[model samples]
Target chain A: MDGSLAERVDYQALVLPYARSPDQDAPRPVRHPVVIVGAGPVGLAAAIDLAQQGIRVVLLDEDDRLSTGSRAICFAKRTLEIFDRLGCGGRMVGQGITWNRGKVFFREEPVYSFDLLPEAGHRRPAFINLQQYYVEGFLLERARALPLIDLRWKNRVTGLQPQGDGVLLEIETPEGGYRLQADWLVAADGTRSPVRRAMGLESKGQTFRDRFLIADVRMDAPFPAERWFWFDPPFHPNHSVLLHQQPDGVWRIDFQLGWDADPVAERQPERVIPRVRALLGPKVRFDLEWVSVYTFSCLRMERFRHGRVLFAGDSAHGVSPFGARGANGGVQDAENLAWKLALVVQGQAPASLLDSYDAERVQAADENILNSTRSTDFITPKNEASRAFRDAALGLARDCAFARRLVNSGRLSLPSTYRDSPLNTLDAEAFDGPMQPGAPAADAPVRAGGEEGWFLAQIEHGGFTLLCFGEAAPEDLPGIGGSPLRPLLVVPAGAAPGKAAGLPVIEDAGGLLALRYDARPGTTYLLRPDQHVAARWRRFDPALVHAALARATGQG
Target chain B: MLNTELNIAAPDDFYEALVALHRDLTPEQSSLVNARLILLLANHVGDATVLRQAMAKAREGIGPAGQDATLRTTA
Candidate 1:
């Protein structure tokens, strides 16, 4: 049956207890090509990608309405690229707050301020501070307009039974129970993933001893729009009073509560207002918007996938929010998994490729979790001796430039690559040099013939971007032996590399060798559709790259 | 790299120097410089218990009366 016609087939009619009203009748059992659990960013992204590839998706969420809580506000540059590829990057970039610099304070005084714009090259959008709920609302609206996606709110997945060639899911909806069978299942159900739990995957990590109070307050007094960390003693000695301005006049302030601070006592406006007044001084007036308590936990699932069912987002890993890496990492995971899943469903690749998703993404998640944990540990030290030590050290950095950079980079969220990835080639001598495979530092100018552009812009279009250091032609390197995956144009220095067909390449004047890809190279990177470094090799090893591509496309 | 010159000062001297340096800085510059100092010191202390107590004390001192006393009034 044609996919367009199949999409038109009434799923309600195929299932049991069909009635005039959806609420009056029990949900009818429906079989979809793919069933995704959770309607959050991760699940929705996966659904959108798969649906675009002509796959039918049934997205289930237990919530009766779209989530209204502004959970994640920080969107990294790499995530923005993903949004761009999804055709919604402009919408988000338009609505979000672009924060280029931040200030760190001791008491009410500023110690350092640095711009997020990289020292060189055109700046990719730094970090955006739009509410996560707004992003979800935008994605949901787009997802609903698609004919191939059926988003069911207030429906929860309660049971899973592996059937022949597919899995059967027992869904508990408000109307009643129903069965959903699909060729593949994805769990984006968040940190406490029911899908992951049902599969009995153990999530491993530690919980911190401290708690934090996060509040969105509307203040009348002027506050720096930049992200600021205030480390004052006495009132907030054991706590970090950090603040970031939203798109509007609203400000989000996070106060690190003492380990012994009572949650009930902290939530009271009377208790919080006094602290706000004390910090801002008597002249500043403010109104509390919302308040909540959060504890830091760093954990990742043992594996991202189990058989045909896979996990993405918080279901796979949880990290402290210091770097805003948690949600960004999850979205990247979806980008990595989506294309591979689509290829497999379309019979273009082998299932073994799915293993690389686990291999590559788990490491990325682990790294992000570790970085966030370290950042949190530093910001919220647990002892008085440590506190004094921190104070003195920060005081010393007051006069130091290098120390400031170290602290700033640790807080700034950037893309990280897997240097030793089987898909990437490492420059033996330049290993210590800038262009390390996994380092997200701004790309340097490479002169191929005479033309010039930042290394990132050259590979930003996605797919395998071969950067020839010497005067080597594209034909000289190994051609993509199998699959329809497009090869980008070879950019020679001087002339702007125009998008050839759909594959665009840029040539550099500074002769630099090795290939730089936007996504994980297949055969080389098995490149995730979103151009993050997935894997690599030093030279064109056809056998290995071929095997990798096979695994990535799921042909093997 | 550790600044031997900065690390060699006595605790009270170090605090006094920080106060003097902070007083010389613009408000925007003082906050970041101070926060960075606090982060570095925290890393070296290696004890969470002491850090927590000190932070509690710092918070209390940041109130109106405390801020006035800790900061130089002349500046």
Candidate 2:
């Protein structure tokens, strides 16, 4: 079985041997520490994180080839930070399209323009709009480079059952039906997940009546790279469209289909091109790369995990693509779950730590679903009355400064905190003033402290952060426990106010700038790896904070 | 865990205040407020048998004081 001879064999013959051993006797079966179903962004992300922690992983995907469809395109700042921790941030950042602004148009006139990235912190830019396929490709490349990751393409998970202390996975490969036993299983197979169905979990939510059409095109026209939303293009009354530019010069346009149009007929170029030309104006030339028609739906699984088998990404929840939260949320789910699983598997933390995965991530999924639903509701209003109302609202906002600020800031996609989470605490007096725990302060400059960079320059450390407001010393606050929770770090607030931090910190803005930093005397805020405030306190509440940390790490 | 009363609202006062607030709000404010209200209402309606019936009555429209005359009659 030399390399050249293996390559020369009939492709079918090579696949046939593995295909014959259908019941757990295959060569590569039952050896993996963890088996992840689906090699999409979420699954690959889990593999990357776990492999980095020295755990062997087996990643399976039913597709014969890598995904080419650009299903999801938006990557938020928080998601980019996760990539940074995985050591692939530079490659992804280089390949993604940085979008900082968006334009909203009413008929022919520009009604509003929003600056999505008004502030830059220590990490990468605020957000990037890259094709989802490229992101997965980048992750796949990185995962393959790791010797611990075994990526098996064209392999489908047919049966999953809890076996012994681990789980048994029945996979259908070109060779045959093979059985695999792993310490844990992650189901990232998507909305109609076999794992979820096997566990008998039901996804409950609302399904909209309207369908949407998304097209990726290469065009010669000079359209700005900023995201553009068109409300009621003249030729197609009541229809809406969104235009976004990708890094490779491909443009993605999402059009709201008329309720009466035949989805099959409307997708034809003759019908689609006319609508696009009418909106872009008749003179511009373009080439359509891909087009897809899908009806939007929102759903969240009743539970993300059953015993040792867990679900992530679309397997756990499904959201309309309006807010670009689908893929990003899934990636976050893996990020949140991976570390906890790794700690438990390595015996650094108790098994109970894995329980917080559902507690925290389910809350996040519900939030993502709600945000996407609201964005969809606004974009594709249901009836004539709703459409009219939306139009009037946009028209009114076009002339008002307050309305313009609200519309353009895009506060919805900003990072959110789990203030009330069992893993978090609240500091009533700490995050006071206009800057609260859950939200970012508007246009707050990152100034230089005693350090070289400005405030906010310390957030790039990629671990739990303690931002001490006012003049409190970091040592005076509560100490973090060892092992699983030993990674906590503290720095001055606004270490580099205007610049992004390479590490997280605490700060002192000269005088009593406590009002600005929301600091009250001796308060502290503990931030999670994703930069969300996990816990806070007016004073050093070590007993409660320790309990929270224990609970978050599953030591409880 | 079953705090049904926590999910319940003072229909007469709350509904009236909501209508008044909706009427007085600017379009942008109204939209934002409406979105928040929808989420709040949905949270309370979770897995409740009475939710569908309540939504049906509310959809028929509310009076100036925020109470749904239809809901009052049905109740």
Candidate 3:
């Protein structure tokens, strides 16, 4: 499946046949602004994101094929939103099995249930159970479509020399090795990141001893598209089981095999079948698509950014699969670094802005690790008292609503708000709502240019966006010096169009946009290029906006 | 905030009912039931201040602060 037609990559590579690259023929090293290694979800996201920002991104992967198994099947809403920013969210939501409700059972009885997304007005579902291959295939397809992205298959990073200004990488391709120079390097490599190994960096943290067996079964089961978790079931006593429906009539079943259970023995059909049969009853016929066993660790690097090289995804921070934070957190890591790297490369902002990526993603990593670790502990209690408390909570949860809060099947995943990020301009004018400085901008429906669209879609076009919500549109707002700011005027649902003389007027349809942002008559919000709130005010003020823009861009 | 003062109207009757609830149960089962009871009562008394005060009271007779939270329920 390896070929040397480096100039063009067929869309059918979605079938995942490796192809050779023209980099093997380059007489001298070709320098790209951004070179992203490992074309998994994180790398592809980082590549596509940078390419979307008009940065020439060289995406390299050892294999051209998608991930072999149905790994990292659950993608959270925050991830789908990030994909939307990369122009592929609609397809993801459409292709994946969307679910928001998850029920946890104690023995044979359901003890706890949670709605991930109770409120409406958001664009995507709480989560979608799409196979990792489908996600990577879609991202790969999107990355290939971008002319700025130079995607090289069978390109493995063997050695790296990180210098003061840039990094020189030694790449191994099917046609042997080639040297390439990158102004900035992004390592989205998996947990066993070769780049991190080459740099002598270790992602250190605690490892949970328990192993989980994942069996992707192709079946026409009459199961609703919701997450079902069973703890200490009658069939599989003293263990946990999780069930999720995926696309293509495939169902993901996870059986918590104890710490001492041999992964080799547990993955076999003889051992896994009886467990599934016990849970689903004998009448249900299903074909095993894939079987794998995994043990997880919640780990992260001391810092994500190392001079000219930046690490994103599993390479930067690795979390357990309990909360499905592994892939979601990694995709977010890419999103966090993309804009800062783009700015730094284009000389729009100082290189110091990249440090903010380390600060923020490290915070996010710590958050994910903490949640995943807690969930692991709850699921597999180490001590007698902990197990006693866990069972006590589950026991009480059968009748008591408060006991449900003590139940921790998995926290799922939520986007981390950069509440303490140095980039945020803390609100000078007090406002009510969750859209605080550094909070990820919440999505709501709006009407713009006679077409109904998402509020996030308006700010996602990139760069600093100043959104002014009010009845009286201040004809035009003054631009912050040096930095370009796209100002949007958001009026109430029934407000007259063309209110802001020369600016785009977004009608907050159904009042959801206003309600979600807690908009007052003259409220305004300044959103960063990554669609995170930079600052907000009761009214528009040029001086305040200028100061926020400077701060968000790292000038302040 | 916690009505650490006798709050139950028929305190002795409630105590008898509680004792009856643990009847014919193993020590582990009784402990679990007690834990559940604590959770339910604390939740019913939903005020954070009250719960914290109650928790402080519960922990008072256990041990010193440093070693108090550590469970000795080893295998």
| lDDT of candidates 1 onward, in order | 0.64, 0.66, 0.85
Candidate that beats the other on lDDT, 1 or 3, i.e. the better one: 3
Give lDDT tens digits, candidate 1, residues A139-160: 7756877889887877878989
Candidate 3 clash pair list: none
By TM-score rank, best first, the candidates go 3, 2, 1
**What are the per-residue Cα lDDT tens digits for candidate 3 across A1-556?**
1122324333324555556555567788877788999989999999899998889998888876778888989999989999998988877787789999999999989888889999988888999999998788778778878999988878889999998779999988767889999999999988999999999988887776678999999998999999999999998899999999998899999999878999898889999899889888989999898899988777788999999989999888877788999999999988989998888888989999999999998999999989987888889886666778889899888877778898998888899999999999887766777999989999998888889888888878768888888876664473442255888888888778545666778888879988888888778888988888989988888888888888888899
The DockQ of predicted model 3 stands at: 0.21
Q: What DockQ does candidate 1 have relative to the true complex?
A: 0.04
| lDDT per residue (tens digit) for residues B1-75 in model 3 | 766578789999998998999999998888788777777777777899988887788778686434211222100
Candidate 1's docking class is incorrect
Clashes of 2: 43
Report lDDT (Cα) of residue A383, candidate 1.
Answer: 48
Compared with the true structure, the alpha-carbon lDDT of candidate 3 equals 0.85
What's the candidate order when arranged by decreasing lDDT?
Answer: 3, 2, 1
Q: What is candidate 2's CAPRI-style docking category based on DockQ?
A: incorrect
Q: How are the candidates ranked when ordered by DockQ, highest leading?
A: 3, 1, 2
C-alpha lDDT (0 to 100) for residue B43 of candidate 1: 61
